[model samples]
Target: MTDTLTDRPRGRQVDPAEFAYADELAFLAAYDEGPRPPGWQLTPRAVVTFIAGSGGTAVELPTKARRKGLPSRLVIGQKFVGDRAVVERCVVTLAGERGLLLVGEPGTAKSMLSELLSAAVCGTSRLVVQGTAGTTEDQLRYGWNYALLLAHGPSPEALVPSPILAAMRNGAVARVEEITRCLPEVQDALVSILSDRSIAVPELSGTTDATVHAVPGFALIATANLRDRGVSEMSAALKRRFNFETVGPIPDLAAEIALVRRQATSALARSSSTFAVDDAVLEVLVTAFRDLRAGRSVEGWDVDRPSTVMSTAEAVAVAVSLGLAATYFPGDRDVLSLVPGHLLGVVRKDDPADGAKLLGYWDGAVRRRAEDGARLWRQLWELRDALTD
Candidate 1:
C-alpha cells in the first residue's frame, strides 16, 4: 500500500514476507488489472502467482503502470515449493471468505504458506495469534488495558484488541500458528468468530461498541502440525467452519535438493556469509533425508524411517549449518563429514531407536551404494562412524 519497503527500517535480521517481497506484491497488483474480491489487495489469479510464481516466464506491466522507475518486466519467484493446485485451493477458499486451515507435518512450511497467503491477500501478515499450551481465549478474542480498565471502568477506550480483532476491524486476514497447541476449550473461542463473524463485548453492552462485526473480506488462516497428535484436537463445530488443506513433504528429489540449496544460500547471505557447501554434498544430504523419510531408497532398498519427520525445513537448517561451519571454520573438516552427525541429530529428535535406524540405513543402503562405487555415497558410507563417534 505504501508503494515499496524502502521506507521501512532495515535493522531487523529477518523481515516479514510482506516487507521482503513488497516489489513483487506491487508489480503483481499493477500487472493484473482484473476483478478482485472486496477488501482484497490482489486478484485471485495474481495471488496464486504471488505464491506459486509464473513458472520461469517474465511478465511485462501494462502501459499505464509501465514507467521508468518501475521495471517493465519482472518474473515472480516461487516462494512455496509445492503443487500450484494446492495454492489455488487456498486462494479460492479465502475468496469465498471461509476460514482456511493448513495441516501438515512439522516443518513442511505450513506456517510459511499461511503467512504468504495473508500477506498477499491483505497486504500485511503481522496480524497473527501464535497458539501455545498457555495461549488463552483472550489472545484469540481480545483483552483490556488494565490501567485504563481500573481507572475508567470498562469503556471502549479500555479494550485492548488482539491481532485477530484488529484484522476483523480492518477486513484483513489473520493467522493462527500451531492452532492445535492451545487447549481445546481455549481453541473454541474462535467458533463464534468464524461462524458468526462477530465478537461480542459483554462488558460494553448497551454501548455503541457492544459487538464487533467482521467486514466483507475478513478471513482466518490456521496451521496445525500433523505430528502434534496428542496436543489437542479441533472440535467438530470449529472444524466444520473451515476448509482443510494438507501440506506434504516435497515428492520430487531434485526439487527438494534445489530448495535446500536456495534456502541455505539465502539464510547464509543474510548473515553476510557465503554458501560454500558443495552441490554433491547437498545432493547426498537431501537424498539421505528423502530415503529415510520414505523408508526406502530410490533403488528400492528397505530403510527404517525414524519416528521423526524428516521435513524439508530441517534439511534446509542442516544445509545452512554445514555452510556456516565451512565458512567460519575453514579447512578443519569436509562438509560431507558433517552430514551423518546432522542426520543423527535430526533422527534423534523423537526417539533413541531413531539413531539405531540411522545406523541400519548406513549398514544397508549406504553400504550398497558404496559398493556400487558412487563416489559421493562411498564418501558418505565412510563417514558412518561419524554418527556414533
Candidate 2:
C-alpha cells in the first residue's frame, strides 16, 4: 500500500474514508466487498461516497475506532453538481487502467471534479501536471537535473521524476489540467504513457531499468476545455486511449440555487463580508441565469444569449454580493432590488452583443414577471434602469 503520509508528520494516520466521511465511507467500505483494484485502499463504493458525499443517507460503517469525530475530514465537501452515473463511469474507467479525459467549457468545475476524484481514489490529489504553453514532454515523462547528471552521470539521484512518474511508482492517480492548452506534440506525449503504461528513460543509463511500469491502482485523469477546440485537438489515436466524459453546466435550478448559496457564503466569509440577498433575489438571479444560459425564457419565449457562458459559478458571485449587501446594509428595502445590477455584471460580458442580450432579458423576462402579479419582481422591473447604464 502507498504510504498515506509524508515524513514531516508524526501522528495517527487515519484512512481517507475514515477521515473524509467517517459515517458514510466507513459504512460503504465495510459492506463494500466489491472487487478492488490492486493497491486501492477503499472499494469502489467507498470511493463514490467520498466524492458525492453521504448526504445524510444511512449506510453501515466499519466498527474500527482510531480517532474522535466522524471518520474523515468532512470539511472538504463533495463539489461536483452532476449525474452520479457520470462519476461512477469515471471511477470505473480508472479502475480499468484507462485514461479518463474530462472535456468541458470554462468554469464548469472540471478541474475540481478531477481533484476530488483523485483525492478520493488514492487519498491524495497532489500528483498533477498543469498543461500550459511551456509544458514540455519531460513534464509528463522524466527529466534529468543538469548538475546531478553532470556530476553523478545519469543515476536515480540525477533523475527528476515527473508527476506521472511519481504516480507510476506510487500507484496514485495523476491529473493533467488544461491538457488542450499544451502544444500538440506535448499532448501527444501522453499517448505512450496511457497505452504502454510506462515511460523509458534512456538518459539514466545503468541506474535502473529503462522502463517504469505503473504500479497497481494507478490511473490518469486529464481535463481539457472545449474552448481549446481550435488550439490543439487530441489525435484520434490519443482519443481512443481514454474514455471521454463531458461535464456541462448544472442542469437543475434548485440544485444550482443550493450550490450558489453555498459558494456565496464561502466568498463572503473569505472577505469577512455578510451576504444580504434574500431568497426572492436569489431565485430571480438563478432564474435569469437559467433562462440566459438556455437561450429561452422559463415561459419558452426565445431569448438571445450572450456570447459569455452563463455558468453556475457566475451565479454564485451574484448571490454572494447580494448576501453581503443584506449583512452590511440592513433595512426595510427588499434585497431583490439588486437583481438587475447583478444581472448586468453576469450577462454584460464579451462586448456590445452581450449588452443587447441583457436589454432583451429586461424587455422580455422582467416585463413578463411584472405582469404576473409578482410584487417583488415588479420592483426589480422598475429598477431595470440600473442595468441599462
Candidate 3:
C-alpha cells in the first residue's frame, strides 16, 4: 500500500498539499455526503468547499462510519481568495471531464488553484507536467525504459508512462503549468490526448499494450501566463477542448492585505521566527502594488505602470522579505525604507525601461499622496531617491 502523507519524516523541508492538509482532507472526505463523479475522491460541492473554504462551519460526519479517533466536526479552511463564480465554473468544467485552461498575469495563483483543485478532486496533485521550451513530447506521452526495452523489446514493462498518461490510466486530474512556455509543436501534443481521451502506444501496438483509455473523472488543468499568451499561442483545435478561465489579482485592498499578512507570517514562522512586519508597512506595500498594477493610484493619480506584472503574490513575497529582514537584521534598516528597493526589484524585471517607469510612478503617485498628508506616502516619497540612486 502507498504510504500516507502523514508517514513522511517530520523534518522534511516541503510538504505536498495533500500531506500538509491530510487531517483536514480526511475529515472532509469522511463528511462528504454528496454524490461524486466516477473515480472522484470528493463530490463537486465538497471540492468547492475545500478550495474556497467552508467559512469555518462544522460539517457533520456520518455517526455510524466515522473513523475511530476522528473529529465529528470538520471546518474546511479557505485557501483561494478569488471570485466564487470563477471557481464554480472551474469545478463544473472538471466535473464534465473537460480541460480547464487558467490564463492570467503572473502571480495570480493560477497554479496554486489548479493544485488545490487536483488535490481535492483526486487526493493527489503531483500528476503535473511543467511546460517549458525544453519540455518534450515524451513528457506529455510516455518514454521507453531503455534498459527494459533493450531486454524485452517493446513490452509493457519497457514503457515509462508520463504524468499525463499515468493520470489518464488512473482517472485522475493532470496539471500542466505554464503551457504557453512550451513550443507550439510541443503544446499540440495535448490536443490528441484531450480530444480522444486516450494515448496510443505505437511501439507496443497490435499487442495488449495498445491504447490507454481515460476513465471517468480524468481531466486536465492547464495554466498559461497572459504576458506569454502570444509566444506560442495554442492552436484553435486545441483551444476547442478547453474551458478558459481568467484568474485575476485580488480585487479588495483589505483582503489583499490580509492575505499578504497571513502568508508572510506563516513563511516567517517556518524559520522559527515571529512576524514583526507592521500593519502600516504592509498597507503601503499593497497599496503601491495595486496602484502600479492598475496604472492609477487610489487617489486618482495617473502613474506610469511598469511592463512587469505586479501581482498580489509579489506583494506577499515583498512582505515576507521585509519580515525576514526584521527578524535577522533588526535595526539595520527600517521596514518602510525597504519598500522602495523591493518594489524596484519587482518592477525592474524583463525590461530596463521599467525602472524608469517605476520612478515616474514615485514622482506622480507617491509625491501626490505625500502632499495629501498621508504619512506612509510621505515616507515613500522621501525615499524616491532610493529608486534613482
Candidate 4:
C-alpha cells in the first residue's frame, strides 16, 4: 500500500487512503489510467476498483517500506451487489463539480460508498456533517462563538467553519450522513451552497461581500434513507442541484452470503475466536435473511414481512453471532438454537407484528425446508419453538 496518507490524522480525521482497506485503493491508484479531476488522487475507474475488489488481480506494492507489503487486515472482500454501472455513475458525478445524493433504505451501503469515495479521491474522509433534527444552518454553512462575536467580533478565527466549508477550501469530498434526519429548513441550507457554489458570511463587516467558493475538486455526497421519505423530502430547489442515485439491497443471495461470511469472519477473528460454522449453517442463515428481506423464501414459500428494515448489515451481525456460538460452545449443542433468539432480536424491534412474521417464517419456510431434508435447516426447524417461548 502507498504511504501517502501516513502523516494524516486519525479518529475524527482518518487518512481516507488508510481507512480500512487502503491497499485495495492503493492498488487501484497504481494502475489507474482514467482521467482525474483536479486535486483528485485516482481516476474514476480506479475508485470503482477500490470499492469493488480486483477479482484477484496482482496489486504491486511500493518497495520502500521495510515490511515490503500491506497490512493483512487491509485485504477486504468487496461487498456491494449491483451493476458496476451504478457505481460508475456515482464516480463520474463526483469527478464533475456536482453534488451526489445517495438515497436508499437503511443498511444499503450508501454511506459506506460515500466514505470510500472521499478517501480514494482526497486521501481523507474526515470532513463530515451528521444531519439530525438539531442540525442547523450554521452546521452546514458556518457558525461563530458567541463569546468571540461579543468580544473580538466576527473574524475568521472566531468564525468556526463547518465540515462543508473546510472541504470547500481543501477541494475534498464532504459527507453529510442521514440528511433526511435533519429538519426541512436545516436541509435547505445546501440549496445556496450547491447552486451559488459559495457560502456568504454576512456576519462579518468587510467580508460580507466575500463568499466561500469550492475549490476545483470539492464535492458533497449526502445520504438519505428512502424509509425517511415523509420525514423530510428534498425540496425541488435542492434536488435540482444534485445528481440523485438510489442504492438498493444486494441483488443476489450468493453475493449477500459471501459478503456476510467475509464481514463476520473478520469480526470473529478480531475477538480471537475460532468459528466452527459449516457451509450448510451459513446457507440456512443467509437463506432466512433473504426470505425475510425479500418477504419470501427461495422456493416461493410465502412469509410475513417485518416492519424492521432487513438490511444486509443486520444479516452480517446475525451470522457473526452464530459463528461466535459455534466457536465458544461447539458440536452437539446445536447452533440452530441461537437462530430463533437472534431472529427475535432482529424482528422484535418496536412492533409486535414482527413476532407474527417470525412465526410465519418458521411455519412457511422453516417447516418446508426441513421436510425437504436439508439437515441443518431441519435442526433449525426443530428449534423454531424457541421463538415462541
Task: Give each model a TM-score.
Answer: 0.96, 0.85, 0.94, 0.88
Which one is best on TM-score? Answer: 1
Model 4, 1-389: lDDT tens digits are 33467865334222344467666665556555567889888888777777676565554444442243443234334645666788889989998879999998898889878888888888888899998878898899888888988899768778889999999888999999998888989988898888777888877647743578888899999999998877887888888988999999888888887887877887787777765677667777878877888887878877788988888889888888899888877775677678788988898885866888898888888888889997877888888778887
Q: Output the TM-score of candidate 3.
A: 0.94
CA deviation > 4 Å runs, candidate 1: 1-10
| Model 3 bad stretches (over 4 Å) | 1-10, 62-65
**Residue 389 shift from truth in candidate 1, angstroms:** 2.2
Give candidate 4 misplaced runs (Cα > 4 Å). Answer: 1-17, 59-79, 328-332
TM-score of 4: 0.88
2 against 3, candidate with superior TM-score: 3
Count of backbone collisions in candidate 4: 0
Q: Rank the candidates by lDDT, best first.
A: 1, 3, 4, 2
Better of 2 and 3 by lDDT: 3
TM-score of 2: 0.85
What are the per-residue Cα lDDT tens digits for candidate 2 across 83-169? 888889988998888999999877788987887777767777778999989999999998888998888777777888899999999
lDDT of 3 at 10: 50
Best by lDDT: 1
